[model samples]
Target chain A: MRLPSCGCCAIAVRCRFWESRIDMPLIEVDNLSKTFRVPEREGGFLAAIRSVFNRRFRQVHAVRGVSFCVEPGEIVGFLGPNGAGKTTTLKMLSGLLHPTSGTATVLGDVPWRRHSEYLRRISMLMGQRSQLQWDLPALDSFMVHAAVYNIPKDQYRQRLDKLVEMLELGPVLKKQIRTLSLGERMKCEICVSLLHGPEVLFLDEPTIGVDITMQARIRDFIGDYNRRYGATIILTSHYMADVTALCKRVIVIDQGRILFDGQLEALSEKLAPFKVIAIDLDADTDGYDFAALGDVLAKEDRKVKLRVPKGAAASVTGRLLRELPVLDLTIEDPPIEDVIGRAFGGSSGVGPEEETSAAESQGGDR
Target chain B: MTAVARSFFAFLRKGIAVMLQYRGEIVLWAIWGLVNPAVSYALWSAAAESNADGTIAGFGRGEFAAYFFAMMIVGHLTQAWDTYEIGHLVRSGEMSPKLLRPILPIWEALAGNLSYKITTLAFVVPMWCLFAWLVRPTFDTSAWQLGLGLIAIVLGAVLNFVLNYVFALVAFWTPKLDAMGELYFGACMLWGGRFAPLDALPDILRWLSGLQPFKWMFAFPSELIMGRITDPSEAFRGLGIQLAWIAVSIVGFRALWSVAVKRYTAVSG
Candidate 1:
């Protein structure tokens, strides 16, 4: 069987196609980078005192030459390990930080220039931070934003009602932000941010500490908002479920470099090509050789789990059913967490590609 | 209202709402502001009594009472606390969200300052009036001089605010601005004529105070209201100096702000 084209290569082709049709992308980033100069201090008191007069400094390259463009109405996942320059890139694009070199344009305006016209059309939310006044009800803070954005009284009221109803935020609107649950506060945060109806949204780990149910709800809201407004969105998250659920296309980075950028399914095919099959036998397995079917990855009680190449998974399952007393069985792709772990060169367990095909040869199954 | 004015009023309203939560703090600050003037009045009154003659440093007992009372009002009207605020915002990285807004973050500070002054004055002005009645202080300025002095006081407040804000921008590079704030206040006390009338200081110190912008912030306004500089030409000169300082401060604030913002965003990035 032939493997599909790599997602990263396909992105280049898609970008070229987009360029042919449009003069400039909605968000265009070209070799944008950021570097920092961190001071170094010696441990000893004498050395520290001496260093004060003549400081030692080291250059830290937080973001290297990273280039990518986001088209209008695209919900793209920005996936990367910690310290991989995800937040730095977001800051540069949002005008919070200027890039050390290179340039980026958001909605045809340079982000670092922080043009009021450009700012009024974009919004950003960070998960761990709260922009709402803590001691005041979320409504009051909403009013502040309404004023900041200069929303006409009637328009502001209309938008507030719509957002409140859509988010089911009536119960929590009157409560002070500090008293609200994390999820409730996050909802309010999202609501207040959208009162301006910005064209572009940058969300950085917006569900970091939210519970599973809340995370799902937030993801749904994000999807609904994108569809309703045709708003372009760029989200960075550690949860694979979020990326897989909301993002059809994802950009993966490691060490400030773009490792992969294209369709989400294509990424799985490129990085991890095998699937897992778990079998639960009705009878004891002492008399049969399970390893002949595939490489056994794990075994416990009467259940056996096996790893096999994607192409061979069906044939191997058919043979197992014919030759073994199989009570139940299921085939699934490798978990994305493990795949990304391996992509970052994590050596804690089996490497994604090196995990050879296997049937669960009996160990504890008997 | 124009767009900018609308935004300013909106922020002003929000600031008032937030400040209402800290009413206790306002009361405490008002008390502290009054105490400084009380101390100055007491010291000057004692000096006037001891002088056998009816005057000390050109201040009669009634004149000293009037000077201290005016000084108290001017000081409260011109107070700035932006150094502590900007330092906290820079230190804790809370300035991030503020910067993302279309408006400059400084506008929020300005609005907040205005709200605080307006709210506190409601309570403070009545108390000051009662105190002035008890002290029986005299006001000798003509109607025109009094009107010009009010303008001077407003300019003085703006000058002090811009001066402190410019200094506070140093927090972009270093979070430890408390020392700098204290240093600035100390200079004001020594040279801005908080402790005594500029006439009471050594000739050299008084000359230096006149040359620097410090005296114009507090002493010039208070003295103008008290009619201490009776010469019309001298009073006009004082107003001119205050205007010059205000111009200098605005330019300095913009320059420092540009550099500080660049340093902050670059380093934090």
Candidate 2:
């Protein structure tokens, strides 16, 4: 409702405008699905013995009938719990994996066809894998990358200079990959991946296993690169700081299907529409009947915390102030982690009953 | 053409850097390559000496020695390790990054094969010269014949590369390709003259070797250089077979590569 001011808001507005302006999506996914056949085995040793002679296979639907689209120059967070198909979708989109059914087009080319033109425009960086020639220096790997993408010599040098300066990789570029630390190697990997100047980037847990300082630096570098090059970025990370720091719109999936695909603010409002009210009581609060006012989350010797519906937060505060000997009070939304955890079927946020019903309701939308 | 050359050179440079770190492994593999021919020379030399005519399949003592010594050099020159390398890459999920690249992954193998030969050849050529000094091998061919033999050797190297590449692609469907590799090497050993000269192979195996591509890969070039096949028509026919097999192997490679990539994407997904 308010005019945009912050960098993220401006990005959101710009992304929306571009998304509306373009007739064709830069990345279009239509019911893209992948199913894996895993050999099934029982727990008992006898069953395991039987399985060798008469093997049984089970089908795992890793990515199911899912569809989405991304406009150019947009940063979208693809978030899901482990085994929720985030990485699977990324692989399919990046042409590493072929879908079992349906199709996906990146830069107007079928990803699975793996046209050289299509590949030149996209890059994928997985945290678990290393693209660098391990025995060679990162600089040598950069030249190999430039050759692979056919970047002109002058363009390669200029891009390499900018990346090295931005990533603070001047000192480590000459060292062998085996000699570099994990953070240093990751920085080099990112630099080499971008030297070709791809228009689309699929980053899967790029900051995983790195230290906090390095994680922050990489996140900032990704933002800077995206802004500088107008690259459409799809990122998946377990670290909340990464998602909050970079993505304005998040696509949350569970059980191999999208549960929510919209703004982060809207997700919080829809999933967790309650505020936590904490009051510092003057004395032991055991005597106070706080359960009638709201769901009491915690009751300490001198303070009590209650979860109140957002609409009734002001009334509950007024009643607590008028009736109880409250010294001070504060209201806060539930933590984003808790909201995400609940969305992922993790216990400890919403009750299990509510979590199940909420998941069921959203499951059909896919 | 310039872009292709640049990428090839880039791959070559990076591949050299990688091979340098494995210098120890290169020595061990070179020794392994040499041992096969050395033992064959020893066995076949004894066999020739024991014959009533002091010759087996028209190969006297000097001829047997010359055949295997050339066999060792040519075998090393044309050997391809893509079967094991591609198997490891696919099984360990390392092929993901390669698939993401614009260039086909086969270029990496080709560059690696060339760089490895060049570096180890530093030692291999000296070893060859030492053997030549001791054995005093006879030059039995003209320059034009040697030139044609060299072209055949190059095409033979490519044929071996594509052949091993196609064999390695089977790893995408099955996890274990060790047995397959052993089977392939056994066939090469029997029919490709690794154990003895192709002239020493039994009639059926000789027929089979002539029909297949392995003899062109290993024996034909050595025989051409050693001047065993004196008939010009036979020499030209060998070269023609090498070219035809190279073409066939390339077609097979492209077909298998697409299917293997599809299988990899489907299963590894």
Candidate 3:
């Protein structure tokens, strides 16, 4: 006798068969909110003693009415500040948490239900947490992972070899996880998580606490993994380079809500509607009154930087060239970090059309 | 073998390897397991010898030695620390990765529990033999009683593990469970026959012990191995009660685990 493909029934096989026929988002979340009831107490012994009979609690809305969808093979960056619910949302998607309200489906199954099949197809790596046994070698943890995922011996060996080669983990495989450096441990973590070839990957700050060179290497590995396997990845990183390098589309979230979602390049256009013009003058004109052109961001010996509205960038540059002896001139969008800071600071001067609401951003795919 | 069984064995192997790295600490813990039984045996035997008939509560000094010796073995085999461990895992955000696995985290915890027992056996078995030789414990157990006693020990271990794990689920609701863990251990010491034999307890306390599952986990197996439960019918009845409590504990575990996972906030990350 032979087992079914799913080791269950023909109906499940048919369901998979039909699932492949239709084009659907690999992950779909709608109004997914999570509120935590956190205990609160005042300082001092008197307040603490009084709180034994009457305790206080504050409800924290960690993720409120957030919605999003991810297409297959898309590396979407989940950008947010600390306590902005990025990890909370990922935890819910990875089945580590239950939503207070609303629903989410990953690979056509409810995530919080934590079905074995769903879990086998997805992996979430939290940089602060160690999936590997601290006292054991990386290889031991990998073997345990293989057994838990029920990977075939041949496939496990093949994937392990490839991941080791890709992640440069061969030297660290035999070293105890606690003895390894943060970068080596992170590489091992990535290697073990991908041993089973998860279709969906959630990486929360995968490059955190590592050197710039290691962060770049990890970023490159993530990009290569996404391309080679076409795995849909949702990455959260404090490093802008990680997002800008791997994710063509970025989701900006703040205060438990999605502030903006679309192409990474569109972020500046929507949030910071200004162009920076830097000019190198032939001679220093102390009385030129450069502020008359636009907001003089900086004025020095022979170089002047101006922040002009997007609509006035062309005219401002023509005037500077016509009046001043311009040696070289360049126009560029503001840095992504500055734009994000402004957005979070609520000083972006956003219009109704540019203020992409959480609901609107749900469908604002690239 | 099935995938779950394979995973369990792998976890067990890894747990044993981890335990070997902390040999000194484990030796101390194993010694501590012996101290409780040794002190209880010394106290009870001294009291029994003070009696005019060389007995207290129908237990002679040799009988008391046998009882405590059996208690030591049964207690070591049935020990579970999840009630102390789960709170730390939940509070420290360490349980998240374990929960991500396809299998329940309890299987890994159970493997770790067994690994501690298996690794400490080398250090503890010698100590047990030394104590038994020094005390000259009497043994009237027949081969049949020994066979049934082994089965009771296995069942009692399972019952204790399941019950402790079920109680540990309270950590999901209240992560700081040190007080709870201490309270649970205190209850086991009093009601599970670790402090004194159920036979020597006050009539009301002994009657209460019969109604609780702790006595089934510790006293029944220890008594059967000590030849105190001589009647075949009574021994089998004790085994039945152990099985029943195990079944109830497993059911309770299933119910509590679902609610606990939902309640998990994955604090700190």
**Number of the top-ranking candidate, with lDDT as the measure:** 3
Off by over 4 Å in 2: A1-22, A43-49, A270-341, A344-366, B136-139, B266-269
Candidate 1 local lDDT, B1-269, one digit each (tens): 76667778878988888778889998898889899988888888888888889788778889888988988999888878887788888877788888888888888888989999888987899889987988888778887678778988898888888888988999988886888888888878878888788888889999988788888889988988887777878888888888899899899988887677777753242
> Which of candidates 1 and 2 reaches a greater DockQ?
2
Q: Clashing residue pairs in candidate 1, if any?
A: A294-A358, A294-A359, A295-A358, A295-A359, A296-A359, A296-A360, A307-A358
Q: Report model 3's TM-score to 2 decimal places.
A: 0.87
Residue B188 accuracy (lDDT) in model 1:
80
Weakest 10 consecutive residues, lDDT, candidate 3 chain A? A1-10
Enumerate the chain B TM-scores of all models: 0.95, 0.95, 0.98
Tens digits of per-residue lDDT for model 3 on B1-269? 99899999999999999999999999999999999999999999889888899998889999999999999999999988899999999999999999999999999999999999999999999999999999999989998889999999899889989899999999999999988889888988999999999889999999999999999888898999988888999999999999999999999999999999999987733
Q: Which candidate do you rate higher for lDDT, 2 or 3?
A: 3
Q: Score the docking of each candidate (DockQ).
A: 0.47, 0.54, 0.59
Per-residue lDDT of model 2, residues A209-314, tens digit only: 9999999999999999999999999999887678878998788766566666777666667667788899998866566788998898888788789988889999
Better of 1 and 2 by lDDT: 2
Each model's TM-score, in the order given? 0.84, 0.85, 0.87
Residue clash pairs of candidate 3: none
Better of 1 and 3 by TM-score: 3
CA lDDT of B51 in candidate 1? 86
- Fnat measured on candidate 1: 0.47
Q: Is model 3 an incorrect, acceptable, medium or high docking prediction?
A: medium
Where does the lowest 10-residue lDDT sum fall in candidate 2 chain A?
Answer: A2-11
Quote the positional error of residue B112 for candidate 2 in Å. 0.7
